[model samples]
Target chain A: DVKVTQSSRYLVKRTGEKVFLECVQDMDHENMFWYRQDPGLGLRLIYFSYDVKMKEKGDIPEGYSVSREKKERFSLILESASTNQTSMYLCASSQGTGSYGYTFGSGTRLTVV
Target chain B: EDQVTQSPEALRLQEGESSSLNCSYTVSGLRGLFWYRQDPGKGPEFLFTLYSAGEEKEKERLKATLTKKESFLHITAPKPEDSATYLCAVRGGYSSASKIIFGSGTRLSIRP
Candidate 1:
């Protein structure tokens, strides 16, 4: 089955530590997205990459960055993790156009102390 | 800005009870409306996709219908297995890499 895989299911990091969250898609889709889910904010987009090496900021991209060095892998980076950044991070992928539904990863729950 | 809103943040029902969940949205252009079911600690599973008003889709005891302003997911004789958080999302006008907007979600519980 087509799937989006996130490397970590749960993670804990220090306040100033740098964290890396990895995602890989086997569907060969062109668009990959990163979203953070909070209590009342719903799912807020952090960043997304439409093509290899091409990244764009989403609605809530302040504390996060992304890298897509290859077609299948997209990485989310926290330059300096903070307590406020702790949340359930989701990864999703879809074809560039005409794709109906997005295939989402199981999600990574992160905690910063 | 495109926005999707779901009503009744939480709902409780007895097994075999029937009800409907609402998803209201406003967007520049409506490409598609989607319904997903998310069990705790798991990713959202795609359930149905409606492309236009007056469209309907069904699977088992779940049926979804769409209108220009909103969409409804109706459950007929729901079972305990159907308890989960139902999420609604919309894909619309193209400006960003991804145009999909999601609602906060409705958590449903069914008692035996």
Candidate 2:
């Protein structure tokens, strides 16, 4: 089974602080994604990377950025964290095009104060 | 707009009770419908993927059936361990992007 690992299970960040959430996946999948899970909002995609050094903006990419320097790792960056950004961040990986589905990591619960 | 919606925001069932959850979608050219189980304070675990209308997949006490406009996740004789949030998602076949739209999810609770 493919294991997607999120670097942190829980994190607290002050407002205006820079935050980095990291995710790594085995099985050499080509597609990786970052999503924020909130009550009543479901899981909204923040960003996705199809290949190394490639990235695409999803519906909720306003307050975030992403890095995909390597094939196995994808990272979500918050240039300046805010209270509204406090939510569960999920990392997922899939094969190219994702016609199948995705395998998700444990997730990082970020509380921005 | 392409979107997915799950019905019955929350449900409470007994251990031997049987029930089904609904997932309706409006995305054109659907490639796949997925069901995932999410425990509290954790990421979702992939459950089943239905590719086409009339396709059905089963694992353990759970079965999923997909139609062109909706999908149903049926849980039979569920256990306490089955209590969690069930999320449904859809993938757009027309687009090359590997992104999926997810529903808010239905929280299920099974009592002994």
Best by lDDT: 2
- Where does candidate 1 stray beyond 4 Å? B94-98
Q: DockQ each candidate and list the results.
A: 0.60, 0.77
A1-113 per-residue lDDT for model 1 (tens digits)? 77999999999999999999999999899999999988778789899888999998999998888999999999999999999998999999988886377889999999999
Q: How close to the true structure is residue B81 of candidate 2, measured as C-alpha lDDT?
A: 96
In model 2 chain B, the worst 10-residue window by lDDT is B92-101
Which pairs clash (backbone N, Cα, C closer than 3 Å) in model 2? none
For candidate 1, write residues B79-112 as lDDT tens digits: 9999999999999886544468899999999999
Task: Give each model a TM-score.
Answer: 0.96, 0.96
Cα displacement (angstroms), candidate 1, residue A89, comes to: 0.5
**Per-residue lDDT of candidate 2, residues A1-113 (tens digit):** 99999999999999999999999999899999999988887888889998999999998999899999999999999999999999999999998854879999999999999
In order, what is each prediction's RMSD in angstroms?
1.3, 1.2
